[model samples]
Target: MLHRIARATTAAGLMVSLLTSFSARAIASEPPAHCRDIAIPVSIAQGQPARYRVWGQLCTPEHRPAATVQVLVSGLNYSHLYWDFPFRSSQYSYVRQANRAGYGTFNLDRIGIGRSSHPASAEVTLESNAYTIHQVVAALRGGAIAGRAFGTVMLVGHSYGSEIAKLEASAYRDVDALVLTGNAHTVSVSAQQNLAQLGQPVGQVPRLAAEVPPGDNGYATVQDAQRPEFMYNVADADPRVIALDIATKETNTLGELSTIGDADAPGVTALLRLPILIADGADDKLACAPDATDCSSAATLAAAEQPFYPHSPVDAVVIPRAGHAINLHRNAEMAYCTIINWANRALGTPPPSK
Candidate 1:
């Protein structure tokens, strides 16, 4: 999942013990396709039908059908590739770690980004994208994916994805729980700047200008050098990891960006009744505030969320020394472990230690 990168003053971080990963795998079956393609049919509020030939991959510890499944939605400008990062395979991949922990993880590209179909940026608004998420969850529950109906399904999202998941959970009440990462009620000016520098449209980039769609003016990509500045904690992130991100970068549409803040809009109910987790990096400059103020600690961030979810039980954690992309930091495992533990408890599955 892609998260809006925040400025961080210090760094040390993503983790993996090959053994810990192996032990987390509970099912005896071989892992399924590293990734697969599926087209999900969905109709928008306007009754317009469009097919999302989504790119997704699922992994579980056991061979039998998973009792609970986590449908992962990535943030803006990212695709399903965000979940199963190829760089560290074992080290930085949230998907690998989650499978080792025994819960099934299904990672998919959000509608207009990555391998999914792109209808003009105008068609990919927050509400439409939320509808896309709704259909994906329904498909999982109905056994359209991997042909194994899950007894329970949890929705996991990072940054923009988290916002989309929030909308779906609030409006449709279709999910059992939600794990929202790289998200907060507020955003920093630095974060906004990060969004601004994310390159011009496809036609504007030197190499892509000529062949791209006629009016693809709404999508943008991260500039090469700025890639780290936008998505990684430069002080400690692996150089190679940063390189892969820039080379494999995707596009973020203006429509999605303009409506992203609606993640907190009054359009949908604030989740005061659902079980939710608010996860952010201790050094996250963006979610903290415009000047990187506010989220000085995990407790502060959690407390900040209280007003928004007055009646909901909320628990928050801040990954130390990590920036916006906790999963990509050196201590990525800490982020992974925190989430897997929370998810296990929410889904009623045996903890990874068990």
Candidate 2:
């Protein structure tokens, strides 16, 4: 049956070689055709106008210019690397896959994470984060970040990033399409438990202490030992990938976590009038477990989410045997293909045949 074949393909993709010499050589020899680090200045409200820089990397394809640019946003406790993962770059890097599919990618560190400026943790909320993303989107469309302006913009988000995307798209209605991963209307009990225990003050974690500004103790990160349990399905992931994720993990703020569920408010998602793709890993304990949205298959997931997106033509895909961090999983290639292919169809841009 087709279902059986699909499952087999996912399993096989995970079993593919991790670090062959040939892969390393290919990676070293071929970098992105066009890549640049960008810092966009944004002003957000915290009782007064506060200015900060949102950092990101923009990369385009080698042969032809991309017509549609994807603005990638990471989830809680993750940085820009979540979208363009470094380890096993050949299989797990969504940036590489998007470029190969002829789409430009802007992988960003949200205002309070990674290379971006760290404002007082209390100033960083879902609304402020969404406003920051709005500025980035405006900058991209106005040709402020790169010399070239992108007419078609797609917002791609994972987990908490997905929530931000929902808020931005609803509030601004600026993007052409939405690709939301690791998110749904329902939250699993396991996800709540993981969230409740996942974070500790940034100052307490030696690895993250230097990353935050002095006297600001509001940023938090998942404990290194608990990361694999919270974010990955060990059986379907590479051990090296897990180690790399922990080593490169980033911070999330208390403000961001406090209002994380704001985007799920009734009538918010229903305001959008664009093509949307909701993708999640079947084994993602955070979003696909008991009492959460049914992610057993695309149809089931889409049906469950239809009420939330009454104005958009929404499609869903459930990656098999993967966890919360879909891009870091061995079968990430499938997830990449699914997203790129859906974007192509939604935006009317035909992808080059693989």
Candidate 3:
């Protein structure tokens, strides 16, 4: 993996554009053949620091330019290039298409996941995560470290990261496009119900921001690795996803819970100010649970309830024979193609269709 750590010596002034330059050569430490690490502090009042991983090639136009910038934000417990990212899904085709179209691709793993800095006590709440993303945007836009400016950056987020993407799109004016995957309307599982489902005592489930041991509450153990197929079937169809999977653990239970309830409700799914695409697996447990029901239903509910943000155009779809990670499963390339097509049209650079 290739990575470089950068600290903001001066405050990233909001109005004045303070640009920092980082040449590709400066990124001396190559991220794993597939991963890179980046750190930038949050601008939030006393908010903890934020860090993320970058993946894929950042080839320039003369090389393989598709879209201007395509960023993939992984769900909790997953880091950049963590899994074997075999390009099996339609999503892969979309990435290739984006590259062909002139877009540089990147993915940022939120704090507490991946190689990013974990707060002294991991603060995995949605609000904090949203704040971290805000800092990331500021750093990226202000040229804090990598100093790369995206002409047309598209945000692709899955599971919990989808909520973060929504927050970023609604709160920041910088993002041009948005994609949300594995969305649930309201967690079908209430606090009590969630405990029962997890077979834990009531009130034992940690808060949205609490940190638990890798095996404390919501984790899949090494012993459970025997069924890698069942645990991560969605990643199997793609070598890239598999590679990514190998680098991550299922120890983000608190992070997932934090995305639910009043703690998670404040800023998540607020309003969309830009074009948005939402995709989900037909049978994702998070979307098809007792309260949520299914992926399509959850998408519709989220869109309908947040009617105030109607100015942003929206499209939703459900993938077949897939679970939570639609982009890593069967027909992965189709998923990517669909999203890229939507993004292209939104960015005013529609691809030539056959």
Candidate 4:
């Protein structure tokens, strides 16, 4: 089915190749209107019931229902669609590739966004968001197919979603590997320096100078740049991703402890022990301190900062004409292909070379 869809769309020519190469049949199956409109009333500790929705097709390769799953953790404002929501028929190609590689995928819609119930004026915090992810992981773990034929689980998180992924790793041991993009913390100086270079100054710099989060500055700078797919999804004009991004920016501006850091490393510093990969666009205005520092070069002396996850080497690629939305950029396939290759090696299942 996927091959036929690819061939059909491919015949349309290169203009359609971007969406078609990935195949389109996976999302062709219509999710029940009700399925697309989920209202999960989840209780966050003693707080109000957090609402969220789960869209996109969840299945395995061979078009059969397999167990192993690829849970997607979204960025600050981007919703699950960036991960699974398919606009074009060919968008399903990403899923088909994952399935072909022997893994199922789940794109999470964090609370207060998407079809999820939106609490009145209550924004989603990292602690709150992490708890929500914990629930999802726990559910999948108990889903009768986890850790068995499913074997191990892998996590792929972008931006704020990467922060949550670190929290999930700290809280959940079932996660075997992590694939993080633009993953930085509140404390990293690189985040701050990058923000300044972009002509966007963070207000908290004066007060929280002693203990501001590593990636906060950089995250802030990156979020300001608008991306289209995140802004315009057919399902909802205002995708929860936009909401998440807004909520995260607001929270960061408020300077609450949304990070998982202490004196030394912000959350993911210790991930060196785990199989991890951190990739960020060189042109990303947010690329700084904890993400990358200046090497011993006269040129980089000004923008110099070392990476946080020293154990897991950061693949700081210079993606030309790319902004914060590296995944959806014209060269996004290159980035995804890199991460996928790394994941395959980490999972002991590298794909066959062409």
Per TM-score, the best of the predicted structures is 2
Please write out the lDDT profile of model 4 over residues 210-234, one tens digit for every residue. Answer: 2233444432222355333222221
TM-scores of the models, in the order given: 0.85, 0.89, 0.65, 0.59
Number of the top candidate by lDDT?
2
Candidate 1 residue spans exceeding 4 A from truth: 1-36, 62-64, 204-212, 267-272, 289-293, 352-354
Better of 1 and 2 by TM-score: 2
Error of 3 at 117 (Å): 0.8
Q: What is the C-alpha local distance difference test score of each model?
A: 0.69, 0.83, 0.49, 0.47
lDDT of 1 by residue, 77-168 (tens): 66776778888666788887777666778888777766666767776778888888888788888988877677787888888888898888
Residue 225, candidate 1: Cα error in Å is: 2.1
For model 3, give the RMSD to the true fold. Answer: 12.5
Put down candidate 3 lDDT per residue, 1-354, tens digits, no spaces. 001001111112210221111112321222212223455555332433323332233333343233366666776544554222544422443334444444556655565554454443235566666666666665555556355665567777877677777766665666888887766555445523543343222124233223333333443222223323332344435555555554444335454454544323444444456766666666555664446643444244335333434455556555555666665575554455455555655688744321
> Any idea how many clashes model 1 has?
14
Q: CA lDDT of 176 in candidate 4?
A: 72
Candidate 2, position 333, lDDT:
76
lDDT of 1: 0.69
Model 3 off-target regions past 4 Å? 1-67, 82-97, 145-147, 190-247, 253-256, 259-270, 288-308, 352-354
Which window of 10 residues has the lowest lDDT sum in candidate 2? Answer: 13-22
**Clashes per candidate (backbone, < 3 Å):** 14, 0, 44, 26
